[model samples]
Every structure is written in C-alpha cells, then in structure tokens.
Target: MSEHGVDSNQIRELGRQALGDAHLQEAYRSSTLRLYTHRLAAVSEVPGFERLRERARELKREVMDHLDFYLAQFAENVERRGGIVHWAESAEEARSIVGEIARRAGASEVVKAKTMVSEEIELNPALEKAGIRPFETDLGEFILQLSGERPAHIVAPAIHMTRHDVSDLFVHNLHSQPTEVPEQLTAIARRALREKFASAGMGLSGANFAVAETGTVVVIENEGNIRFCTTAPRVHVALIGIEKLIPRLADLAVFLRLLGRSGTGQKLTVYTSLLTGPRRPGEDGPEEMHVVLIDNGRIATLADEKMREALYCIRCGACLNTCPVYRKIGGHAYGWVYSGPIGALVTPQLTGIQNARELPFASSLCGACRDVCPVKINIPDLLLHLRSEAQERAPAPTPSGAALGERTTIRLWAWAMKRPWAYSLGSRLARWGQRLLARGGWIRKIPMYPASGWTDGRDLPALARKTFRERWTEIEKQ
Candidate 1:
C-alpha cells in the first residue's frame, strides 16, 4: 500500500465502481465535455496554435537538458532579491521544511492557495500534526476541505460536485442558508475565507512557472484568492516542483498563451501575479518570501532518456479532458493526486511500478490525449514503455491450470497465423463456433476465458459468412 492507503493495483475494482455510479458518470461526462469543447473553440481563434505548441515543447526540452545550470541561476537570482530558497529531495524533507518555516514564523494558522504539489506531499496533515491549522482558500478547495474529499479534477477541483451538493455542504458545514444559486455559494465561500486571509500569519502557494532568468515565481488563477494567499500574510511560501523551471522570462509568453487556452479556453486567466522576492520598501506583500525547490522523485525521472518527455507536462489538464478512459473513471479512481494519461505515467514512475502496475494499462491508446496536449507529450508511446517495464518487473506467473491454458492458447494462435491452411481452417471453425453466441450479427456474450472478459462490457461483431480470400478469388475468376 502507498502512503495514501489507496492501492493503484486496485484500479480495476475502483474503475468498476466508478462505472456503476450514474451520478459520477454524468458529472465526469458533462465536466470533461465542457472543458474539451471550450479548448476547441479557444484553439480555433489562434491560427498559430501548432507553432506555439512546438515552441513550448522545444523550450521545455532545452530546460530539461540544462536543468542543473538553470536551477543554480534561478537560486542565485532568488537569493539576490532577498528570497530564501530551500531544497528538498524527498516528500518528508519538503513537509518538514514547510513545517519548520511555519514554526519559525510563529504561525498558528496558514492560508493556502490550491497547490497540487502541497497535496502531493500531504502538507495539510503535517501542518495539523505540528499544531497548526491550514485553511484552503480556493472555492473548489474550500468545498472539498469542508466535505473531506480529495480534488476530482486538476483545474476544477470540485468538478464532481453539483450546485445542490455545494449548497447542502455549505448548510451543514458553514451553517449558511441553502440556496442553489452559484453567486450565493461563491459569496458565502468568499466571506468565510476572508477571515482566514486576514488572520493567518503565513500564506502558501504553488508556482505555475518559475523564471530562471529573474527568479520570479508566476502564478495564474481565475479567482483572486491566490493574490491574497501570497501577499496578505506576513510570510509567504511557494512550493515548486523542480521541473517547473523555464530558462528565460521571454519563454513565458508562449506557455502563458498555451496554458490558458488549453486549460479553461480563456485567452488569459483573470489574475497573473509575478512575485520576484520579498516585499520591497512601501510594498503591500509578505515581509519574508521562501521558495522550496522540491525534487521528490523528479530527479530520478529526469535520469531516464525515454521517460524524460513526461516532464514536459504543464498541468493544463487538457489530456484529462480529452482522454476517453479518464472521462469514464474520473480522478479518484486513478488512486492518486494526479489523474488521466499523464498520471498513468507519473504515478508509476514516482510511486514505483510495483505499487501502480495497473495504471499504465488503463488507457485506450486513442491518441486524443497526445493531440490535445499543449506540450505534445507522446502519452501513448510512454504508456507502452511503462507497460513493458511493468511486465518485466512483475513476479513470475503461478503455473495454474487456467494460466497454462492461456499460454497454450497463445502459442497455438501464433502457429496458426503463420500457416495459410491452418489459418483458413481456424477461421471456419471460429465462424461455426460463434454461431451459438451470435445474436443479430453481434456476439453479446462469450462463455469462456478471455473472450468472456471482452463480452462483459461490450459486444463483438460476428465473423463474415464469406472470407476476404473467397471474395478475391471470385473477382479473379471474373
């Protein structure tokens, strides 16, 4: 079992449960369809969208190639601007560093913007263990915080919840009146988080992009709460993954354009704050600024040549919105903080293939994710790579009767495929055998072995009455 006690090996069972729930199906279908549609409309407006994607991919490749140089330069610039940079090689170290920073600041409570890295490290529990309360200020995050559920989507964390769900949760937790109006719900959350923003001694966030040229941390959001989380408190902290670094400030423009359009279908987000360092003279921001550069398995991922392309992901959630498998199973079913095609690659690599062996096999290889990706990560290719690795690392199969039967079946099939006479005879046998199972030109159910598994969820087309070889022979006669 992993740290979260959710086994990625149980993905098949979890996926089955997700498939059975009508409400979850509706929530995922509607939310992903909306985002996917918005992205299409947004991309159509930009004639140079493909060029932008290529440029972004090249920039990311350059940064990954010379990551050591950029990290040093970024750290030097950050310290030059009076910002403290802390390095953490593991999740435990990262959490300890954040807890110590809060303690040094004498903070009893901290306000946090929605940062997936923080969730990745399980920072909230660490803070609470050290006798500090951490408040989530993002509307979706706040709703999940009160309801005690993990985020269901990357951009829209509360995408699984309906307006009625939010209204009911607010009534029970916030002691507010029940109303299905979206504006009323937003007002209620805003009113509640304002107190946390005012009283909290420290604010925390995750950097969307860290400019190595000037040591600037760039954060974008549709809600204004992140601005408060970074500026209103006496001390500010940003937890950044090591892969979040970009080489130059000029490179930011291409990514900013891609991220917004790919994420929410907006040309640009509402608030894009660029914080260089601590508050300057007469500035209205935190007195102290800290940026924690966290590795936590990323360095290991960077070491692999073929797998390094996974690092190019910008977390726009476009892949999730466009993935056929993710549209059905949702985020929680992935059994980790990250979800969808990107998650399938990252989770196994970060958590170990033994822990998440089933994740790589969860995709349909439909190429929608790769098509929609802003950075153009070849998700299908990477998935196949991981699948091969998982099989290699998997334990030796037990020689049970069923297992032996499967192996024998595969060998026989291979032999028949290599011989024309055997292949033709086998097809004739299959056609006659399938007659018992076929109904209305489709095989709705199969009573044996691997064929039963296919029929459980979907129907298979029945074999044609005449073979293609026979049709070709008739044409030759003519």
Candidate 2:
C-alpha cells in the first residue's frame, strides 16, 4: 500500500481490536450515542428547523457558485486586517508555505488546534521532518498523537478511545496512576498538556468558516485548548480550505445557527471565536498572524457540477453516527483522511476515482445522513454520483480469480440493468426461485451463485407469494 493510501483491511482489524478492547468501545459508544441524541433534541428545539436547513442549503449553493469572487474578497480582507494570506494549490505547497512561515518566524515548537486539512496534507509528519515539533493541543488529538493513530471521527477525533484506555495511556505516557474514571483521566491529560500549551511558540488552527466581507476566520470548539493556542502564541496560523469562505458576515448567522445543533445537539458551541486579523497596536495577541487558504483538489471539485455540493459539508460528523456502513466499519475502512457518507463522495473526488473505487459501493444508501445534514447535502444522490464515477474506470487487472469473477458479475448486472426486458426477466426468475427457497414463511436459503453467497450470512426475506401484477390478474378474471 502507498504511504498516503489507507489499508482498509488493517483498519478493519484495528477497529475490531478497538471494539473488542471493551474499555474503549464503551467510552466511544456512550459518548457518540449521547452526542447523537443531543443533536436530534437540539434540531427539534427549533420550530422551523427544516426551513432553516433549506435556507442554509441555498446559502451554501450561492456562495459556492461565486467562490472565485468570495475567495478574492476574503484574501483582500485578510490583508486589511494585518494578516498575510497564502494560497496553497497543493498539499506540498501548503506544507512549504507553512514551513517557510515557521522558519522565518523562528518557531521550533508549534501547537495545533483541530484541523482536518492539516491531516489531509500530512502536516504533522512534515513539520516533524523539518525539525519542528508540532504539538496537538486538542485533547482528542493529543491522545491520537500519543497513540500514533488517525482520528476515528470528524468532530471527535479520539471517539474510539475508552476511558480505561485513556487511564492506561496516562499511566504509561504521563506517569499517572491508572484509574478508569473519566474525570481522573481527563485531569491527568489536562495537567500534562498545560505545560506544552504555555511553552508553545506558535499556534496553528483550521477555520470552520471565513467571512469574506469581514475577512474574519471563525473557529468553533468545545475545548478551551484552541482558545489558549490562538491567544498564547507569538505567531498564529490558520489553515482553511478555499471552500470555507462564505460571502457575508450576516451569512454567518445561518451557518452558526445550524452548525452546533447539527454537530452535538448543543444550542450553541461553548466557544465561537471570530478573529478578523492580528493584534492591534494596543492589543495583546499574536504579533504575526497568517492564514493559509489551501486549494488542494478543491478547484477540480469546483468544476464538478454534481459533486461540488460535497464541498459544502461543515464536518459536523452527524453523517458518520447515522450511517449504517460507517457505524460498522468505522473511519479506517474508508481508506482516507475522510470516511462516512460524505467521505464516500468527497474522498474519491479529492484523491481520484481509481484511488477510492471501493468506497462508493460501501454505503447502504439509506439516506439517513441526507435527512440530518444541516446544510442539507443530498448525501444519497452524491453516493450514486460517486458510484458512476467509480464505474467510469474499470478496476485494474486482478491476479486472483475471485476478483475477476466478481468484476464479471458486476459487468453483467450493469449490462442487464440497461435493458428493461432483461431486468424484468431476472426479477421474475428471482421471484420463482424464492418460492422454493422460502420455508416457514421466509427464505432461509437460496442455492444460486450470488444468492447462495448472500444467504450464507443473512436470512433472505422471502418474496411475497404473489406479485401485485399476479393479484391484479385474479381481479380481472373475477
């Protein structure tokens, strides 16, 4: 596997290990289920919740349509606010831009707030390679950093960690006595991180939204760490994807309203900071502030009429909790910086169709995510789009005959679906087979090439004894 590519099989095994680890699974399950329930309650609080989603959808659509104008406007505003704006066309460019800024600023140790774009570009590894220590200030990130693991969830990075696992880690890494309680474990982490926070020379963050009119970058967080990172450091740098820019300051009202409700079911995030520029002459803040606007495949995405909607995602991770496939396989199985329904669409486009060919087919197409999205990204529609994108290029040559047979079966199904009569005939044949296969009022087994394979693990619900068309035939005879 390539260094950049995710090993899904390995991830699957890891997820299983993590799941069976008992201590971590309960912590993860409890935390995730709580957040999921809260989000539902928060959205329910609003009388016109669905209406707000519709408006937010329109706003995102409008901003994305005139993205060029907003990006230019945002850059200009950054300059006016005593901040330099750097445009990074690729991951390497983003790294080099930040690296250059760090070198010139004489920053040896940098503290990072939660930023997924940085992960996409492998920023921590790059910074380490440059002899600069990049510390993860977010508690979730800090844990994953210690464990040398990738984030398991979008909003909650270390969602996979159990309280007991945390206790073990604190016992090992921070030299604290082992305790399974959440409070003690958190206290240990807090004490250890405070020293790093105080000594950090620079702070790096990712923007949730950039107001083009004000050139203000907004960051929303539950933890106090991001606040400390931005305020304590001599230099502050923000990394944001180009799609993050929204047109007006007023437009923030709609996004902020929906963001928290969708993310954790909180009426509002604990902290919502909107910083337009660096410290003024009288202000006590970072002396130097820079914002890196990263394009990395965003331009290619912008050109895509159908898939551009994927760019509107706010990274709430609601889709992950709701997605049946993601719930089973977890983030690692998607094989990229992203996972879940949104990842199913965005990953293939961000990398290449060839790179994420298997991901589009991973979804159950239940449309649960589409119903929950604050910005109303039509997730199921996008999944279908990705599936088409996947099929455009044939899977590479497989030495294994199993893979070849599977490919042939898929090809045959695709061809048959194109012909209405062939599809109807296949459906009729399937119905006929179900008549015998079904026993005790349900299909317990079906002995056919694919049906047998499917029924091996799952009980097949038998077809209705008579089709609607057949029932209609009896009515006509009567």
Candidate 3:
C-alpha cells in the first residue's frame, strides 16, 4: 500500500507498535484461531479433498490460458445484459472511474460490500475527496473502517480487534454506551448500518468470481450486508480483478467448493448471490449496474509463465490461516492489503521486482500454503522464483556491518561446504556451540540482530548429543 513491495516496512513499524499493545494481539489471536479452526473442520468434511483440489487447479489453468478470450467474451456478455463494463489499466484509472461514477450519479453516501480490490486502489480516500462518505457494510470491514486501520486478515479484516476494542470504538466514536458482549455489539452495529443502507445512493462491492459465459458476477459472504449493498442502493458498482473471470456458470461449483472449504471451512458462505445486471426490466435491483474489470499489474503477472497461477487465488485466506509466520506475527506484518504466503509471492511480483524484494525471502518455505490452497497454487515454488527474480532485478542492498558479518560467515560456510570432511566438522562444531550457548534447551539470547526476532516466540530445539553420522554408524552395526 505504501510503496508497493516491502511497501510494508512503514506499515510493519506501525503494526509492531500496535502488536505491543496487549488488546490488539488478544483480539487478533482469538478471531484468527477461530476462523482457522473452523476452516480445517469444514475441509475435513468433504470426501476426496485432494481430487477437488486437482479439479480446481485444472480449471484455473484453463482459465489463465484463455484469459484474453474470456475477458472479451465476459465484457460482451455484460454489455448484452445492459450493464456497462469499464476497463482500468492502472489503479489510478480504476479509482477515477469509480469516483466519476459516484459524482455523476450525485451520490453523497456509498455503502460497500468488503472489496479488497477497492482497498488496493485506495478507493475510499478518492471517494472521500469527492465529498462522499464510503461505508464498509461487512461487519469486519465496518469494525476496521471505524478503527481507522487497514485489514489485518484477508477474509477477516478486524481480526486484530478484540471484543473490548470494538465496544470502545462503538461507544467512543458512535456516541453510545459500553459493553464487551457480542450480541450487544452486533446489535449496535446492525442498527447503525441499517440506517445507512436504506439511505445510501450507491453501493460498491467486489465480485468473488465473474462468470464468463453469462456476464454474471458472484459474491460470497457470511453477512447479508453484501445483499443489502446490491439491492438497497439506486446504483451498484462492482470492482473486479481480471483473473476473477471463470468460463461458465458451471465452473462456479468447482471454485465454490474449494473456496469455503479452504478459506473458512464452511459448506457454503451464508449468502451466495449471482447478479446479472441492473434490475432486469421490472426486477427489483439497482437502477444502474457497472463492472470495472481492473488490470492493475495483472497483465504483467500474466506475462510471466511461472507466476501466472498466483492470479487464480479467490482471497480465501486459507494460506494465511495455516502459515507459521503469519499465525504468530499475523497479517499486518506483511504490510499490505493481501498477506500471508500468497502475499509474499504475489505482492512483489505485482508491485515490481525492486520495491518489495525482501518479501519472497520472508518465507520458511513450508508447503502448508500449497497443500491447503484449494486451487493448488504452488506457493513455495513461486516464492523461490520470485526470490530469484527480485535478486536479479534489484541493486543488492549496501551491506551494513552486521550484514557484512553475515556474508563473511556465509563465505566461510561455503569454503567448508566445498570440502566434505570440513563441512561435516563445521556442522558438528556448530551444534556443540549451540548447546554451549543454550540455556535449558533454548537460546535465551543471541548476540546478533535479525536472529533475535526468531527467538521472540520460540525456543531453539535441543541438539542431539550425537550427530546423525554418529547415530547412523551405530544403527549400521545392527
């Protein structure tokens, strides 16, 4: 959001300050764990899980290969349905288009259905500049918009706020009372949003998937707020990334299966609606319907053969829920609209090779993300590829004293690695050094800089008294 890639460093500095505040951490952990656990349970219920994943992967591959054809067909279909389709080549154009729509319509208030693409384009700021209020109708998004913060989780935006925080925000900002209870908080929000929904002139939402054959946009959500946004406003606008287009109405079943099971672990979201066009003739719908299909660096990503699968993501947040680093540090640490393993690979790729170069290296390369991605996006492989691309494109960082020290250490290790006995000896000696420095089977402190962060939440594993080579010989005697 800040500068693009590691565009998150400024964000990280801010989020670290927030994470230190106990209330934020408590709120983040509780909500994330609950969503993560629920998703796992739901995925387990579906038989032939791997087979479902395979189908999704194949379908996505097919769509990615024929992206241009599908985009043309989809645009034609939307036009046929009497809906205007706008093509935005950049984030700036996309923002201007939406703003112009709202301005031309003479709309003062806009209700939103939790769109990440809008966030990516900073649409709220643009709408506000036009003297119009943009309201996030989804519950989590509403909480975040109220908190004056960005979403920490992809699917769960207010995952960083605890019950008490929400209560405080409602009472302090909305000029109301205080209570930590869920039902009461929900009631307060519902009452407030209900008033806004009825009066808003325009509703904006992100399409979960756009059907190529029918020119239909599908939105999946737990709250009825999305439905509210679609019907309550006189004008409706949906912002979608180009890759969200899938070929047919039938393909929806494949993604729908994988989407909920992998993201939130439900059989289906609370509401899955297909919106074709503005109230069709006599139907009760918005007076005008417009779909702005955004390219916004997607075409650049499409050009790369290796990274194209990154576009197939449905924003399920499953990979985030399962990431070891994400689970501990959380999404804010990634410092962007999209986070977790998917963010690490795709953000740098989309933003540029030079800007967010550090992100691809942030992963431990755990395959959890690829395993859990219902669409089977091979995240680890993509991360490695991005790492190579980032290195090839960027001017290597000017090494500080600590980085020089690390380079020297690596050079020494390389020298040893060239000789088998020396390499073995160095590894053996290193394990001894670790044991000597450790206290109670964990490194209590490291006399270093970045390594200190690793020790923050975990203990170093205890070394085996004997090396694997030693143990192997002993086992061989049997």
Candidate 4:
C-alpha cells in the first residue's frame, strides 16, 4: 500500500533503486565492513565467546518460555520501587499512553535517546500532535531527524549517508559551516544536542534489557546522551518491548558482554546505565520514572511456533553487517524500522505475513547471519517457514479473476518434476525455447510472463544443451 515504492511488494524495485545509487552502495559497503571487522576482533578477544553465546541463547529461551510470569514480576518490582508501568496492546494504544503522559507533565520538549519502540509506534508524531516536541538526542538519530529521514540501519541508523551528505545536511539545516571530517561533524552534533538535553522537560529512552528480579532497565550507549536524557530531565520515560525481559539480575553479565561486542565491537559500550526507579531523596535522577511495556504484535510472534526464536534477537545487528543482500541494497529497501536478516524473519510476524510476504524471500539463504548471531537464531529456516505461510495465506482470487495461474504453473512443474520422462522433455523444451533469448552464456530477456522480471537487473544463466541426468546416463554407457 506504500505509494513510495518502498513497501514489501516493491522489494525488487527498492533494491534496484538502491543499487543504482553509487553513493548509497559505497556508504553501505564500507560501514558494514568496518562494523563486521570490529565485531570479529572484539568477539575473538573474549575467551569462550561461543560458550557465552550459548548461555545468552539459553537465557533468551528461559525468558520467552515464562514471559508472563517474568513480566508480572517485573511490573510488580517496578511499581514497588515508585515507578509506573504501562502495558500497551497495540501501537495506537502505546502512542496514546505516552502522549497522555507527556500532556500531564506539561512538557514542551522532550529529549529522547534512540528507542526503536518509540519509532515502532511513531511516537514523535504523537508527541508533536500533543504539542510536545521530541528531540532525538542520539547522534545518528539526531542526524536522521535533521535530514527528515527514517533509520536505514538498525544499529547505525544513518549508515547509508556519507560524510559529505551529512556535511551538506548540517550546513543547510543547522546553518553550520560544512565539514566532511567525522570528528568535527560529531562535535557539531554534540554541541547542538547538549542544548536540547539541558532544556528538555522530559527524557525518553528504550531499554536494552529490563531485569525482572531487580526491576532495572539497562541501557548501553557510547554517546553518553542516554545517561544525560535519564538524569537531566525531571521526568523519564522508558519504552521497551516485552521480549527484552530477562529472568535475573545476574543474567546481565552474559548479555552485557555479548551486546556491545556484537553490536559495535566494543568490549563494553562507553556508558552502561541501570535505572531502577525515580530519583530518591538527594539523588540526581528524574523525580518520576515511567516504563511502557509494548506488545504490538510481539505476543502474537511469541505464540507462532516457527517464529518464536526471533524473540531471542538482542538487536545487535551483526546479521545486517554480514548479510550479502543488505550489503547490496541498504535497509530502506526493506521499508521498515528493523532491517537485514533478522528483519526479514521478524518483520513479517511483527507486521503481518500478507503485508510483508516479499521480505522472507529477499535473502540469499547464505546463513552468514545465523553464524554471527550471538543467540544462535536460525534465520534462514525461519524465512523459509514464513515463505510457506505467505504462500498458504495468499488470496486465491484477484479483483478480476482467479489467482490460480501462478499456482497452476507451480503444480504443473511439480508434476513434471516427479516424472523422469516428462522432466526430461520439459528440460529439452526449455533449452530450445531459451536459445532465442540466450546471448553470451546468459538470457538477456525472457518474453514469458513472471519470468520477465528475472532479467530486469541480473541475467539468468542459460540452460545447457544436455541435462545432467542425460549426461550421467551417457557416461555410464561409455
């Protein structure tokens, strides 16, 4: 339904557009490579990284299995410690809850650290509609806000933009002198955001992990803005997906070790803040703390047998960096907040199978993402499962007539594949038919319907004159 040609239905089109943009391709390639290399080095330095990954995986499984109990326990602890917890069953409910909170606080502006949940609910627009301006305090998020763009990558957010692109944006929007140096650009962002941090009435953030036993919301960041957001404002709001819950405080050690290394290759992120509740007497924290537990399709995802492992994702984005498809065509092509291999598997369930049918098929099934996953999520298997679900759920009829043509074609192919003589005959016919289109070992064009899209960007390799089965029989006779 996206008129912008970036929706799930237009995955091929979005990819083609991204591939044509030289700057975007270069930016994506370099940034992904750098992050990928750093992650490798950092994980290598840690002793028994594989064992640590297995422990993290086990912890995730434990949380998912008893999510309701842990959630109730977490809510009780939070409320007991002078903090409030809000449960949101839907994205609209989440935005309404946050908007009401912001309105009650008489907030004019709020400083927000990078919270993907907030993005999930489109919270900034809700705040704006309620006359509260939400400022993105994280550097990458701030850049995106200034440029009026959504996050292209989950971890980096602005990875698709080059230094020169940022330089132009700052110069045009901030009225700052253009500078292409990364350090100077960062400094400029730091200076601009410091004012927002000091003046904002409330701070908003997302939790990386929320411990059930202790009611602690753990945030890891290198920018120091998350700390500032939590401490500087009179009121603090933390939005977290229900899946972020872990059973015990002690479990933090394994996750903390893996998150930083897997995400950005840091042994530990520069700042790891654990906020329990509102500021105590004579404490330098917010006077009020609010935690919004969002379940917009997450509970549905948890129930899905094929997709439950997706909840184990820590959002480290190691999968994105290692994904060949993501490398070729950055995250915007996915047309959602989350992207990459995890996105393909999780987005369909998070959004809907019908809405995101193309996502599962976008991958090359290279299994690189599964290899790098800290929690060992089998993404390729999940994708294939979703593909079957999508196929099963697809409507059998179009507005004009039956949608049975493609299905019939597939059935005919399957029938032929089961019969040796029919399969051989089909192969021989295909080879002869392809001769007209074949040029220099590739099929430059396919006059056939549906197959026409195959040659839009990449060529299809021509079929051989002899089938492999026939060649094998000939060799045996010889």
* Superposed model 1: Cα runs more than 4 Å off: 1-4, 395-442, 464-466, 470-475
Clashing pairs in model 4, backbone N/Cα/C closer than 3 A: none
Which 10-residue span in candidate 4 carries the lowest summed lDDT?
395-404
Which residue pairs collide in model 3, if any? 5-356, 6-356, 39-265
Q: Estimate every model's Cα lDDT from 0 to 1.
A: 0.91, 0.82, 0.83, 0.89
Candidate 2 residues 86-151, lDDT tens each? 999999999999998889888899989999999888899899999899999888888989998788
lDDT of 1 by residue, 1-478 (tens): 4655546777878898999999889989998999999999999999999999999999999989999999999999999999999999998999999999999999999999999899888899899999999999999999989988777778888888889889999999999999999999999999998889999999999999999999999999998999999999999999999999999999999999999999999999999999999999987999999999999889988998989999998999999999999899888888887888999999888888887878998988999999989999999999999988887795324323233454467679899999999999999999999899898899998766577777878999999989899699889899
| Model 3, runs deviating above 4 Å | 1-6, 10-21, 395-412, 420-478
Worst 10 residues of 1 by lDDT: 395-404
lDDT of 4 by residue, 1-478 (tens): 4632237656778899999999899999999999999999999999999999999999999999999999999999999999999999998999998888888888799999998888778888778888899999898999999987778888899999999999999999888999998999999898888888888889999999999998999999998999999989988999999999999999999999999999999999999999999999988999889999999999999998768999999999999999999999899888777889988877778777776788998988999999999999999999889888978995323222333476777889899989989998888898988888889889877755566667756789999877778799879899
Candidate 2 off by > 4 Å: 8-28, 394-449, 461-475
Question: In terms of TM-score, which candidate is strongest?
Answer: 4
Q: Candidate 1 has what TM-score?
A: 0.93
| Winner by lDDT | 1
lDDT of 3 at 188: 86
Which lDDT tens digits does candidate 3 get at residues 84-153?
Answer: 9999999899999999999888899999999989988888988899899999888889888888777888
Model 2: worst 10 consecutive residues (lDDT sum): 394-403
Q: What's the CA RMSD of model 4 in angstroms?
A: 2.7
TM-scores for every candidate against the unseen true structure: 0.93, 0.89, 0.88, 0.94
Candidate 3 has an lDDT of: 0.83
Question: In candidate 1, residue 12 scores what lDDT?
Answer: 79
By lDDT, is 2 or 3 better? 3
